[model samples]
Target chain A: MPHLIVEYSSNLEGFPEAHALDALNATIIASGQVQYEQDLKSRTIRTEQFVIGNDPTALRGFVHAELRLLAGRTPEVKRDLSERIAAVLRELTPHPEGMLVQLSVDIVDMDRAAYYKGTL
Target chain B: MPHLIVEYSSNLEGFPEAHALDALNATIIASGQVQYEQDLKSRTIRTEQFVIGNDPTALRGFVHAELRLLAGRTPEVKRDLSERIAAVLRELTPHPEGMLVQLSVDIVDMDRAAYYKGTL
Candidate 1:
């Protein structure tokens, strides 16, 4: 199971959050990476209070994503997944006029033994 | 820079998101871990859409946290930080009484060389 969390600045007006999630889930499912539809739980968060670097008045914005997966996939598969994710991220590049847009994606793998999934 | 993200289920009502961040920041600063006050960027996201395991109607909830840091601190330091974080997480123990509360913390260190800090 992989968890994807996308955090973006509030000023970004053109970022299609819901559409991007749909595309990502579709892409991941197409890759045959996950077995079930609900295996991937993704969410987005709007970062209203944040300080980017040292500039207090830089008029900057960022959309950063983190995907955590249980250790099993090869490095190449992860790279491919991240590349696809970055492609989706690029769709919102230069979202707001006259603002610096920072887009980044990180793919992380948790140890299979340490990662635990349980039901109530 | 270390980014802290706390994701909790909507069912958990007693988790004071703002308060927990304040305490975490204070604890990290009190430990003399970071040089600047703004070095830490944290945000909370309420998971309104999520599926826990295979249970569709379990009345379950989870409070998961991720702390991402640059690679410089020793394992002992990271362990200490996680322990302190877990302690803070425990403050809201049995948060809403009956529902199962899954609490977890993950301390991840990124390669210092790969980490970049920039301004617009």
Candidate 2:
């Protein structure tokens, strides 16, 4: 199972979340790393409030993504995937007039043993 | 760095996100796990669209949280913290009639060496 969770600052008013999400999904599918494309779950969360480096007055924003996959991949794979995802996010986020937007991508490993899929 | 990110189902008509966020921060502070309470930034993301187990008709919702902490803590500490956070989320989310809500908490370790603080 793979899940992509994106959290972006509210300051990025013009960002296209849904489009970026689809692009991310496409990137993952193109990687050929997943068993089934339909099983990939992706969602976004807008951060209404945030601060950067102790400066509330600073015009700063961020777009952070977390990609969680069932455990099995080596550390190298995670690293490469994270870098690619970061590039996707960075490209998608616009460099507005005066705001600083930090983009980050984190690759997470979900425990395989505890992971379950069944009817509830 | 410590950040609490909560992603919940938008179906929770009456779920108090801001208030529940405060309670979660209080719970973490009470745990005495972090160095500074001020550094702990909490935020919520509402999931507008989601599917549960290939069933579009299923009346189900979920509130999943990710607590990102700087690397150093032992697995035991992370597990205990996750459990406490889960409890807080469950207590805060209302069990609306006929809908099932799943609560989950994930403790993530952020690489300390790569973490940086800077002014732009």
Candidate 3:
């Protein structure tokens, strides 16, 4: 299963949550690397308070994404997926006035031997 | 670096964010499995909208914690840490009225060669 979690600043406006999920899901499906679409899970978390860099007085915005997948993909596939995700975020997230905006995507290789899955 | 991300339902009340963080950090430090305190990062994310299981008619609460660290720890250490985290969650999270509450902890081994880290 590949789980994508997006954490963004609550101050950011015009966030298209549904479109972003579809973009990510489509990217993953187009890659043809994952096992199945049913295993994909994506969601966004809006953070109310956060700090960026060393600035304490100024407000900043960020959209940081984390992708967790069962280990076995080549570096090229991971890189491509990450680039696609970053592109989606860049397209969806609007630039704030007088604020620094940063977008980052990280791919974490989940250990198959250690991961446990069960249905509730 | 070891990062701990806690995602809980926003509908849940009486959440002790600071105390929970301190408890988790202390548990990790007490285990003495990680390198140093500087390498640890912990934060909570309150999700507003979420669905659990097949029940769309009822509200449910969940506390899911994820710990990411450099690969090298034994299974015993991971299990111990997970148990400690679950204990923290169980003790801290209040059971909502007539709602199902579930707690889960997962330890993800971050691939050293694949994980990219940089200062913002």
Candidate 4:
């Protein structure tokens, strides 16, 4: 199981939520590395306060995603996944006059022993 | 560099923001496993919509924290860090009647080559 947390800077406008979610879900499904598409949990969070580099006043926007997956995938697969996610974000986020943007994706392993899920 | 992302359900009331942050920062600093206290980036995000287990209708709340650090830390250190973070969250989060609360922490390794931080 993998949970994708999408964190975007609140300074940005016109975020394509549906398109980005569909693209990411499709990317993971098409990779054939996941057990099921249903298991892929995705959520987006807009951060009002964030620091990029040292300049907080600069017109900067970022789309940072964290993907938590069950341990076992090879390093190559994780790297590829992170790169692909970043690429999708770069394509989806809008750019306006005097704005700088950065995109990053992190693929982290989940320890099955520590993770607990109860019946809903 | 390590980044700690705290994601908490928005439905919960009276979240102890200052206490949680200080406790976490202090926990990491006291562990002596990190390069420096300044190197740890901590941020809190309130999620508007989140699903735990299966039923979305249940009045359930969760505090999920993700810790990303350089890839050389031992497994023991990571586990200890995760547990300590979870314990701090449990102590800090307020519990109301009829609310099912769960706390979880994840410690993830960062690939130094892939993680990019520009001049701030």
Off by over 4 Å in 4: A6-42, A46-67, A73-108, A111-120, B114-120
Give me the TM-scores for chain A across all models, comma-separated. Answer: 0.87, 0.93, 0.90, 0.89
Residue-wise C-alpha lDDT for candidate 1, range A61-118, written one tens digit per residue: 7777777788777767777776677777776444676777666666777799878886
lDDT for every model? 0.72, 0.77, 0.77, 0.75
The residue-by-residue lDDT of candidate 1 on B15-104, one tens digit each, is 687677777766666667777655666667777887788987677888888888877889999988888877887785346756778888
Candidate 4 achieves a global lDDT of 0.75
- Point out the higher-scoring one by lDDT: 1 or 4: 4
lDDT of 3 at A60: 85
DockQ of 2: 0.12
Better of 2 and 3 by DockQ: 3
The stretch of ten residues in a row with the least summed lDDT in candidate 1 chain B is B111-120
Q: What is the fraction of true interface contacts found in candidate 4?
A: 0.07
List fnat, each candidate.
0.06, 0.07, 0.07, 0.07
Candidate with best DockQ = 3
User: Considering DockQ, which of the candidate structures 2 and 4 is the better prediction for this target?
Assistant: 2
Enumerate residue pairs that collide in model 4: A53-B120, A54-B120
The digit string of per-residue lDDT tens for model 4 on B13-102 reads: 788877788899899878887776788889888777454433345566766788888787777778778877877888888777787766
Where is model 2 chain A poorest over a 10-residue stretch in terms of lDDT? Answer: A49-58
